[model samples]
Target: MTDFAVSYFGGRVSLRFAKGVPFAIAALVIAVIVVGITSLLAGSYDLAVWDIPALLSGQGDKTALTVLWDLRMPRFVAACLVGGLLAVSGALLQGATRNPLADPSLVGVSQGASFAVVSLIVLWPNVSIWARPIAAFAGGVCAAMLIQWLSAGKRGENSLRFILVGIGVAAIISAGTSALLTYGQINRASSALGWMAGSVHTASWGPCAVLAICAALCLPALIWVVRPLTALRFGSELAIGFGLPVGRAKFGVITLAVAMAAFAVAAAGPIGFVGLLAPQMAQRLTRAGVGAHLILSALGGAVLVSAADLLGRTIAAPIQFPAGLVSAVVGVPIFVLLILKRANSSQL
Candidate 1:
């Protein structure tokens, strides 16, 4: 009713309102509506977006319901689920690692899955589609395990030195992947490039099922580890000071983070930045403080991934880049801002 309040309300939406909870919820609701409409309307054979609700509820025509049930719906669910996982995994990894730069990709999970998948695709040209996800999943697990073993020091003491080891492994695997592509195998390279770029636009429900299963299995495990994760924020000495199981807890969280990251990459093909951006974006949203609130970060991640997918499909029209590419492009600016914030002040 006041002139100042009216002016403030009319001028712009406040993104920082009360840890931005209201806006985040609004953003999520809007994202869901947008994604649902876009998925129903997208592709060469477009359908009326408004008709989707009837189709989903089995009240529509056979053809419309079939299209929604068989193809568009799967792609829609896959995009949101994988996106949510990638983003939340990023948030979890960063919280546990206590490094802004730490991500599944930075820790070697993406490269591991990428290397395994590309190698299998290139070598076993006879392999079936059903086998690819399995191979990628196996590769991801192997990568996480390798990093854990190499990073473990005497008595399992934790240090940034483990990150250094993971970085080295990532670099080595990355170079090897490059070599596979550089051997004048254009078709193999193209496929590998596509996988590395990451997309859920063409995803079938099978890969989504793999990711969803991981979420079902790993999320509760992550929750169980949450208390120790909070303890970790105060540093190992402080954690030990509070009668927490310092070495074991940190190692467990770290392992869970790696597994989640690896499984995500297998499901969606080495998607990056979601892990880094999701938590940072959520932090800006929460402004309440640092650390993971799993469900909120998941929603934020899902929103981000779906928005990026919509942009990827719509912005270029007939040609679309990977959703992962869009996340990287969007995330770079966020990382820069975080760096600048850290330089100017030490709060993050």
Candidate 2:
């Protein structure tokens, strides 16, 4: 049991872990390593597994080093970060909204980011690439606020009402994206479309670092909000009675969720279903509370996206599928299964 123990907040708090968690986390780590190696070795130019150690040590074949370090590594790292961020974002949103179906992709956050990125790309072609993330973040905030307003959060939380509003917001944003694509120049349209499909094909160290830094900065805030979130789960009245700042905590959690989603969208466009899938999978695998759920969700997200990206690249050889397409392909069935399970459990 001690072996499975994990600490949070500089050991000020201790949360017990399940007996199987260590094994599960270890398995996930191994899976990530395997995927990273596969990504490094199985690209357009294949390299021997033995060569990887040499490449890291600066003694491998020049071509192998170039392929591994410059091209594949950034993408591998980016995919991991994007997946983790998206999953954690989903966890936060699910907690904040008290809705299992709440996810960035479903609730208009990703669509809003997509719309913002496309609008800037088309309407303000002269804007710098660095500005896209900011715009996407702003768009995500707007989307969240719109959802809250439409759902009338001032009255109280209603899962069904919130989800319906999110769907409406997503539809409006999607329509705007389509209109931009419909009338924009062919060249710009194609580029936006590819980005929106969630390709990590052009991954580079700069964007990868950006994603890492953003996660690093947001993590402390997440930790701070976790306890409050757990309290909020009992209801705002109980949360307030417990001395939790319900409104501030809700804002913090939602803002963190939106920011994480925006970062993922900025890095790899709107990779569908990772945000939706990760937290749900994490929840199913563990009975631990919010903190553990968040960590596990991040790990699960990393695995799902990395595996999806690797499969996308290898399944069709020279012709590649975007991770988003793969996630959507895989996620639809999982989504249906979740819905059915929820319904059945409720019936019981």
Candidate 3:
């Protein structure tokens, strides 16, 4: 379907959108808001739905205020931020590589961050918790750089080569992480396992602030990549024919994607499948341009993670499952379905 275009500044500025894009975006926004509110209200602590307004206004009881603000709010915010970041990262990766199967985890970013954080937990148990995010970001960047270096050749970067190298690097990193968990101090390893499970149960204001800052920093990069991402969907050769610096554009997009994924992993461990799932879901929901698709993906991701976290928290009462586990349980079947569909189409 062709897009509807709107012009402003005597056509100097224009925006184009697919027919269903607005509705899809609205639905996703509503879903996120609903899930967030539900998450804030539904937890181990009994919070009446009506009490939310009072709590928000600071007119509620001290304990209620503490529960709402100190405990639930941070977790809610972290889940949304992590989900949105991962989804956007995934969208960027899929566009840059022109591969529907592309994801932050598939590309080694999540594994790198996970390895760094796990290493800290297992080997440097006494280190300050504040350092984990730094370690994660550094590790993720290093891994991405390695992937780029390995993938680049005399002919320039190949998307297939990038994916293959990322897979091999991710495997090696995963093995190293597993070894740390296997041989490191038992108690520390256990703690690391909890983190690796990707729970936001311990989310606090500091990490929330850090995540927000990372998201803010990424905004400009996201905008800058929109045109390049659109061009890249047609392949590097075609993008170059259109006068785009395909190599630099891919590098920039991948770098931006890595930064978003690493920050999310740093904030909330490695939440799997979100980066893979959200963009696909958004695309299926609406035939939109890259920018609209990204907005929809971010909102969809926020809803998915927030709802998963809420279910994990309330489903079994005091015993809470990690958000990442819940997401995997939901995502794995859908992922398989997508693969089957793709395979069938290829055969057709």
Candidate 4:
């Protein structure tokens, strides 16, 4: 294979590794492991770090195994899964739409999912929990289609135009969600609020299984659309001229992305900014090609969510904060800096 090098952040980086592994990717993987291990060990119950391996091997104390295997493990795995899914969803959206601010939450997909779930809970209280993911996926797909239709034009889809329209759609959906809560009984509203707040504190095997199955089903579709998504970054005209079925491919990408986000919302309640932060951070850290960027973005998202959940767990001790709150708290400053940098570089 040939080697490619790029200079980023005033430093020269080389992509000359064997077996197609980049240095940045290796670093991200290591970071994810470190974060995962820390999350496994730093919960409310003080489990000895060394006991984890023994517990996995069926030799640890009953109490330690119960804490590690029963309580913390599910949440840990769910955080990683939800984080990766959200980040990949964001990468696909940003790549397909060429929008710097494209994210599941910001672009109305998450809000749409939230609105659907909230509405279901308020209006159809007897609906099984298993059906919530389907509702969320439907809502997200509708929002994505609406955005596409609203943004279509002779000059092709514009990034800023899509962002503006998505923001409007999100706000409207959010308002509707609020109205549902306002009209519904207090108990149902409170339950819905907790889900919307986005915590993995209640993580259990069922939700984890559902998320894993969704990923298993979506992975092949994601792989199929990668080429078209990469081509799209170069512009729709060139993509169409290159014999790509731009319309069909773009629709497939949007659907795949929205489904992933919707599943994450169903599993973890609309955790915001994993999609936004993960892709940009991955790009800056690696500067590799689109494929590498996608993988790194997924890893980065996993690390961010795991780390944030861990922080929320330990920061207030005995009163855990929702991961969504921590994500917004952390994401807001990074978002501001991104906006400032883009403005200074005239990319905004």
Best by lDDT: 3
Model 3 weakest 10-residue run by lDDT? 339-348
Minimum summed lDDT over a 10-residue window in model 4 is located at 12-21
Clashing pairs for predicted structure model 4, backbone only: none
Query: Residue-wise lDDT of candidate 2 within 101-163, one digit each (tens)?
Result: 788998899999889999988888889988988999999999999998888755567776676
Descending-TM-score candidate ranking: 2, 4, 3, 1
Tens digits of per-residue lDDT for model 3, 29-119: 8888888888888866789989999899999899999999999999999999999999999999889878676788877889999999999
lDDT of 1 at 239: 86
TM-score of each: 0.79, 0.92, 0.91, 0.91
TM-score, predicted candidate 3 vs. hidden true structure: 0.91
Q: Which residue pairs of candidate 1 clash?
A: 90-275
Q: What 10-residue stretch in candidate 2 is worst by lDDT? A: 339-348
lDDT of each: 0.70, 0.86, 0.87, 0.85
Query: What TM-score should be assigned to candidate 2?
Result: 0.92
Off by over 4 Å in 3: 7-13, 126-130, 147-165, 343-348
Error of 1 at 171 (Å): 3.9
Model 2: residue 159 alpha-carbon error in angstroms: 1.8
Q: After superposition, how far is residue 302 of candidate 2 from its true place, in Å?
A: 0.8
Name the top TM-score candidate. Answer: 2
